[model samples]
Target chain A: MAMVLYELCGIDEELRFSPYCWRVRYALAHKGLTAETRPWYFTDKEALAFSGSDKVPVLVDGDQAIADSYEILRYLDRSYPEAPLLGDGMAESRARFFKHYAERSLAPAMLRTIIMDLLNAIHPKDRDYFRETREKRFGRALEEFHSPAKGLAQLDAALEPLRGQLKESDFIDGAAPAAADYLVFGSFMWARVVSSADLVSNADPVYGWLERMLDLHDGLGRSAMRVTDVEGAYR
Target chain B: MAMVLYELCGIDEELRFSPYCWRVRYALAHKGLTAETRPWYFTDKEALAFSGSDKVPVLVDGDQAIADSYEILRYLDRSYPEAPLLGDGMAESRARFFKHYAERSLAPAMLRTIIMDLLNAIHPKDRDYFRETREKRFGRALEEFHSPAKGLAQLDAALEPLRGQLKESDFIDGAAPAAADYLVFGSFMWARVVSSADLVSNADPVYGWLERMLDLHDGLGRSAMRVTDVEGAYR
Candidate 1:
């Protein structure tokens, strides 16, 4: 029984753009596991109904299904017990902090910065569903929420902690990339795939770390299909 | 030789309030080690000159003098090895993230919120030096920076990451309060000891975690002499 991963994709199925999905993708690659990735769209709710989740990045292993990215990552480590995402109990706990930090701080700022770009990059079928749901959640029109200056400032401020951490170490989880690195790299991957705007500058230590992340697992992230050729903008 | 810790204090020598100092204080207690705390003020640069850094929380372990809270915490764990501050390398790396997060995000927001209170709480002898250096750093008059509403909003936003993590675990470092927990708790201790303003609300998970932190090491934080009696305000 092969493992299957449902990944959120753009107009081109090869362009997997969801940050949460990217986390699982990176985690699987880090653990040296490959899964049959099924491109999922925002409107493809019926397809995921079997997993009891209306979300992408849902992992279906032989007899078990994991909905959340964190859950899927934890499941992979526990089930495989080889090439662990979390090194130990204490490391696992600390990784949780980075995961939450990315979720609560980094991703939201990135979302604000590239919400429109993200909508444009997604399949045309997902456009209305994406805009409507996102606008409703934000309680503002899609256009109104797009403030590049404010979003960039917030994103820069949010990156400060990660920047400080990266300055001291090559990766968030120390010598090697771990669950913590993937948790944050997912956000950068989301921006890279959809937005033309450069989120981080070349001088920032985070940019160097991002380059290292892109080089991980045989250039997994660097080779990913992007909607725009804005990688040069960051450099 | 007995360990000696130089802590930053206010007009009343008992009012130990520096956030960095509090991290070392908590680290010492967490390691089940007691140090003879010597109160150091901003004007007393000569007092710390021997240590080669004009900073509080300088841990004098026998003949070795360790400056900086992070260094002190790492030294304690390395030298003592029993009741370790950092559990493992990966955990230590992650704890470094929390330490950096608190230093980069939490402390700056907190400093904004309580700058005036901090000025009022410091020793009269250190007032001129404190105001001069702090004003120079902020690039404004101390009075001009006092916007309670803005400061509170910034502080609340800064705490979102920690609040999210606390919702999932008992402490920042997971099941137990470790260096990560102390790193964040130190900032709260700074607010608790000096400012009468309640930085975090009771409804916040961070508030509960702060309460638990106050209860740790046989009420070490709870029993500390505070310049203001606003600990009840958080409750």
Candidate 2:
């Protein structure tokens, strides 16, 4: 009955808990799924191997080896359909439309920004740890992190669609949180963590909705998990 | 009750009856959904607007507007769960896993090659018509397609996990076609229509899969009406 979410517990300052991982964390909590946390530093190669990817926020659910936050979210929804991630009726379709946009378009921008600032933004103490670890897996110098311009462009393109949605509703779909909210939360959380809070801070309903989500996190004490040591474990 | 599928009938030299579109096409046929065809040219501006984006292979089921091929497929599965796009148990999971890979990874490379030769590859008679239409929607010169390097790299990166699947199984899963087959079929068909015949012919399992999917399309010809145009009637 226990699932383990293996993650990196903050190895650096800029190495915040990945929004990709955070989505799954929220899902497990939402579904009330009993999950054990496996925290690791960037040095922990063993955890990455068994998880099938070096990426954190991997869900080990019994015999199922699920990677990718979206996949993990899907697995959670199917396994526990009572609460329902997409929500009810027409909302399901609307939620999915925005969630797809968030994951496919928006999150990539936030992630790129985080990676681009690896040396300066990341905690100096853990910089070597992250560089050494990622080098082992990606076989590239962290220095060659791709330009953030393309990522930002895609993000802005994605947000163009949402501009109308926020104008109409308090949430991406309507009044309630759906998968889009959570998906965006993960990325926006990254923005929040890295001091790049302007991305959604004043953006209408998203701003208010994000505050509500932060409240939920505070209520649950889930946000207590720091971004430095066990950060990759949650990534 | 007959479910009318709104479709365009003409050849989309760029995207054509790609597996992505055909996935919907076949699903409509399989579910016994009565859909009308609305054949369109790739450059048709109004058609893209009606479809919610400048993309083809959109299916209009009454008022429900489903865009992404993945989202459309999922909608079909939910709306018509009796026959089931995904079969039972492990069969379904394995099928879904392949599809996730196809949509996320395989399609981009196919897009890269196809977009490269678009001008020369589209039907010569429709050349002017095609450019004008595409320009109206995408707002870019047809010749200045930027670069295929990024898309190619993404496609290759996405294919890494898929290469493992191909090595293990023939159909990207097994003997029968899964959703992955349908998802990937769209990209492959696009490649077949837009890439040099010689180039598409040389693309390995992608090339090989195209031949097999042709058989599936052939099957459609006998039982279902071949749609030729997308019209406002479906709206």
Candidate 3:
């Protein structure tokens, strides 16, 4: 029997554009599993009660409920090991390294950049909802994210090590798509999708690699919407 | 033939006892695999270089150099499936859930608590080395950890969810010792070994549970730290 997954979409604006979610989406598609995504507004209380957490990208598979992104990824990997994400030997090691980097290092910095310009982009009514949800998790106002300069600088500095590696290989580990490639693939794709160009500015190899990465997936973003509500009817 | 693992260990104050390292140690013991531990201090830069990062509890088996703690656990689980971490279906799922919680949620707050308290307890002379090393990863001064109140509060709050569960079940999952037990087990054990009764406070079920857990393998904090270093020597 196929597992049923419910993803709370629309809460994280750039989440569809998020490398974390993109990894799950790609894995699901790669494994040929079907899932139901419900477009969620952060202001709505109904979603949280049903999901058990306000976090977007909450996955529900039968009786199982997982919140953290990596846990969900591992669950899928174990459940379906045919088209394995870990590949073989060294490839497995490399995949894990990149995934960890993306989650721990890349995502935090990307969040800083997105928050800096959130108000300018989001619909006025949704801004309050975004702030409230974020404050619940982060324990501060959205104003804290206003000055993303420090975060951006830190992120750029962190990328120095990776940029050095890009000078030689097109991918982080070796040739072809390893675990690291999926990360680079997911991150760059989401950044491009959400219009976060500053994430991958002009640099020797990283910028060039980003362009090449998008080409592999034919340049389309990774997620499809699962729920829509119109005219007082939820579908 | 047993798998050959290149391991980094020792120099008491260095690496300052990471939970990530303990995870691998228990997993190794669980698998009955003996790995050679090479003790390295902060002054010893050569060993750190091969690790690809300045992190300990690193395992180099053949050509693979893995960094993340969770990934290392998975590698151990896959490579040595003899004394299986994930037993049967229900047990496997339960183990995965508990282990995931330990690795993802509990460890972070536990780390914050340990790092904060350890900074305060260590001698003045060693403080500089400790602060400098930790600052590199955590991005702040040990002084920031001077106020462990906030860190402890967070840890308490994070652990609140497990209160009900621990009261009912001896282990995080059900009756048996599973992977989750190892994950949580390692953290508490580290705390117990380094600074006993400081980070974790005693309160009925949780406190009683900790004592019961310690008794699992004859009261030694983990299958007898198989790769032990004696007198600044790499064994």
Instruction: Flag regions of model 1 displaced more than 4 Å.
Output: A229-235, B229-235
> TM-scores across all candidates?
0.94, 0.53, 0.44
Over 4 Å off, model 2: A1-7, A11-21, A33-40, A43-112, A116-127, A137-140, A150-235, B1-23, B32-81, B85-128, B146-184, B197-235
* Model 2, span A1-235: residue lDDT tens: 6898875545442244566767776777667776887765555667678767767778888888788786787788777886666543333323333344455556656555556443444545557876786668656765555446655554554454345445555654345544666766776765555533355536554566666677764443235434433444333
Writing each residue's lDDT as its tens digit, candidate 2 over B185-233 gives 6555545444433433245544454555667645552233222222211
When 1 and 2 are scored with TM-score, the better candidate is 1
TM-score, prediction 1:
0.94
The clash count of every prediction, one per candidate, is 0, 45, 1
True contacts kept of each: 0.73, 0.00, 0.00
Local accuracy of candidate 3 as per-residue lDDT tens digits, B164-214: 456656665456554656766776665544443355667645677777676
The 0-to-1 C-alpha lDDT of every candidate, in the order given, reads 0.85, 0.55, 0.55
DockQ of every candidate structure: 0.72, 0.05, 0.03
Instruction: Return the clash pairs for model 1, or none.
Output: none
**DockQ of model 2 vs. true complex:** 0.05
